[model samples]
Target: MRLHAASLYYFDAVRRAGSIRAAARRLNVASSAVNRQILKLEDEIGAVLFERVPGGVRLTAAGEALARHVVVVLQDFERARGEIEGLKGARIGHVDIVTIEGLTRTFLPEALGQLHDRAPRITVSATTQGSDRIAAMVTGGQADMGIGFDIQRQPDLRQAAVARFRLGLVAAPGHPLAGRPWVTLNDCIGHRLILPDASLSIHRILRPLLADLPPGEGAFVTSSSVQLMYRMTLAGLGISFQTRLGLEPELARGELVHVPLMRQGEPMWSELGIYVRAGRSLAPSVDLTLRLMADHLVAVAREG
Candidate 1:
């Protein structure tokens, strides 16, 4: 069962726990033992792995490279275990996932619940990032899977599932635009806009629309924080521009409303993608969880 070296485990533990002492505590071993293992690991590799820091340790460039390899090696071993145990109806493994921020609010919770219910021992770590970083994490083998928007097609990434939604305006019910069936940029003029910042891909679509607005009507709150944009709009400060993906509960409660934003008389559309590294054979547990999450998002996206 001991396929990888013991030092790799200690290194991975320290990397995750951020310090030798914390890693030792987690592993129920002595801090000196953990430190000795890490020292030997670095000596073997002929490179410094962790930079001693005030609160915790940080990875050096070489550590980052080795950490990625260690994670892949450990995870593949877990996959092999899961694949064998799956025949006995005892699936267990860990899956690391990265996704775009939008789906975390709505789709992730329900999807994760389904995954847990079906594969009770399968542990998952899900983190949110913008589209580009999500793709990079999956492609680099830092994550087992990724869900993102408009990810660039690359030979190393395999598209697993897809969902397309219309980008629209989100508003408090009392706002002027909330009563509209649909809106155009000209129609949205004079209304203060709470917009996603350039870090998010949606901003690219919004930038050109904002440009067509009258010069003096440019008073808008632009932020990298999605929560800030949502809260600002919910407080009736201004309308936010985004997909209806995460606003279902607010809209259902009558606290907010969404109207399709039109461009050249057509609805502005956004696409969400589910991806995994190409040529990687996922464990039954990881594959099942990915499919569960993808199916949930795809079904939600298809809803009118």
Candidate 2:
């Protein structure tokens, strides 16, 4: 009747990562080994923990119930481990953070600089991904905290506004549109555009503004490569649309220009929020990071 820690770790990893393969990569283990441990854990608990769903794994009803307890158990175990490590004069701990792409470009570097300065011994690993992925990571327990835009308020999650920003039309300096005081949505339709892919939050925000245009068209769609977009825009591929923060360095360097839109007063405004699981107690390192996050966001808001 003894439960093994390895089995618990496997169950938690699969639940967090949403797939066995992802869990294996995160844990540095063979996928089959992770699966075997999960099977053993299910047998020990006498309950199924995941359902094989199309696209990815899902939690069954029982799995959902077990997931709550498992998260608490694992979090407490991690806290205990951290406390023990701290007793040895080491503040070793981990905080899994998911963030939107804009912050990854500008916000995260400065924010993490603050965190690192305060807790030099604490390790903070961040995952730079799309908003949808951040939502899933925060809800599914893959991330201890998330910095994102337009986060959903779910019964399983708690959030606080960290910052706010709006989208802007960006193009390489000296590009044809650069001198324009304002560019219209129609102005972009036929032109080469290096905008965010349809799946990104910024793109989603701009969809309605560009809806009159036919499908399978945009100028160009891109996912996570901001530098590539900068280069592409400079190369005359198309005008890129992104948060102003993302274009700051290029804008300052005269490599990119942020142009306001004529059709709208400003592009869609989005709130950057910090989120954590609803009922979880955060570890010291995570709590400190959250505090630093709040301060940083305030600073960003002031500059905004």
Candidate 3:
């Protein structure tokens, strides 16, 4: 006998609720109505569906078997519903977003704000990790999309440039290097320096110059929070290196100054971009987020 979808739904609801009265409460129906459906389903299937107990109902062996199948059917139906609703332009869904800690504070919020305004029902769950971690999370399927500077393309992922940025030398106000027209990397060596970890592309490019600096002089090496590091520099911790976008507010406030460094001429400077898995299918909401991300990048570049 073919089981009805309503019968399966009511059966699962009763099993979860533990009693016909509770099931009725959950389904917004009368207790008698719930009992009638369960009884009708048992008669049609020719098996006892539940065992009566002192306080409530318990599923019989057959009922337990049917419950497992009912759950799968219900879950599959819900998945299909979500897929269809997405195509219908329903904004109700979730997107897992990963990005570097620095961009999350400055660039991402500006972009995400616009995304939420345009698609209020679509929710973005964002997590801030280091650049390498962000790349790993996206490639590993832990996140749907990512926003990072100097994105690395893994075999399983594809990257599209969303914006371009370059790492620059920044010093706190009243610091010795603040008024320089431009300084070579060697010139920066004498002063205390705060640097990004050598593992990142920016730092890797700066490594030769950084290594040439006088021994025991490079003061800081870390990743993933330029804002905090910049603050530390303002506190006179050291001269920090950061992306121009990250230093915008500080530069505007005159709390920090950008001192140009020798351009190595290699594309060590590259565009910040969006990355998605190459072969994996993306949800419509995620695709929309990527599109918005591109637009935001263009706007950011233009404004600068």
Candidate 4:
């Protein structure tokens, strides 16, 4: 038995989907029924939750306030229901996770493979997002966990595990720097550079090292897309600097090589951490997966 009002679910669905019709489609219900419930909820609460906008609805201030509480309550309710089912020996649960694209190529797949063997009955929904969005999803109670490099710090999120990776100069096998053991900032000067822009955390890490290169010394193309950077590097448009996370497949195939970045003879690395919403108790299935991830990531981090 759910303790919260059913209208709250409708409100949340509409809020997330951005329209009554869309939310209805997702819920497999009629739009009028959904709209009716939201109206009833608005009456009961004596506040407007959403305002009509072109092609959709936007949450009002009251709706935003309610959303915060409603999401937490809904998550808590699901957790409680899952725990209660576990107490009855039922081996079923669902988990939602958000993470950066970087992990999708390496850590995520490996961890999920292990999770599949151990918790076959548990269902998982995973989404690819940047570190900032990943942290938001975890802290907003929309996702059970987040794994990313340089997740935006928030009061409602807590780190569960961590990993570190040195930034590497990714070069096509035909590139001049392809076979180097490592390259210092000085060595990369005057070469064409495919750089991730300020939107990505790598921009910040690269800023200090890249400062040594005088402006206009090297040809530079900047983008916010990691995939584009990888593609450009593969096409030999120029070399790009990145961590080894998403470069595993190509690097292993000898299509590309990862030349570690060093400064003053020391490697420069960035951090990746797993996060969860603070002050929430996880269901057994989620807890089990989390422990597995922590073990797996910590071991990987240790190797670097």
Which ranges in model 3 have alpha carbons more than 4 Å from their true place? 1-83, 87-89, 198-201, 220-224, 264-268
Kindly report which residue pairs in candidate 3 clash with one another.
162-273
**What order do you get sorting by TM-score, best first?**
4, 1, 2, 3
Q: Per-residue lDDT for 1-304 in model 2, tens only?
A: 2243788788878887889999999999999999899888789889887899876688888888888777778776776777777788776788888887667777898988887787788887788877767777776677889887767667888885557676567877767778887777777776776766744666676667777876766556565666677678767667887657766676778877888765555555667789887777777777778888988888887876
- Give the distance in Å from residue 105's predicted Cα in candidate 1 to where it truly belongs: 3.1
TM-score quality measure for candidate 4: 0.92
Candidate 1 to native Cα RMSD, angstroms: 2.7
- Cα lDDT of model 3 by residue, 1-304, tens digit: 2244577778878987789888999899888888988998999899999999988999999998887667556544544555778788686566778887677666888888988998888888888776667677675455778777776667877885576665567887788877877666766766776777744456656777777767777766465456567678888777876667766787789888876655554323546778876665565677678888888888888776
List per-prediction Cα lDDT, in the order shown: 0.85, 0.76, 0.73, 0.85
So what's the TM-score on candidate 1?
Answer: 0.86
What value of lDDT does candidate 2 attain over all alpha carbons? Answer: 0.76
Q: 183 in model 3: Cα distance from truth in Å?
A: 2.3
Q: lDDT per residue, candidate 1, 229-295, as tens digits?
A: 9899999999888888888899989999999999899999887888998878788877998889788
Error of 4 at 52 (Å): 2.1
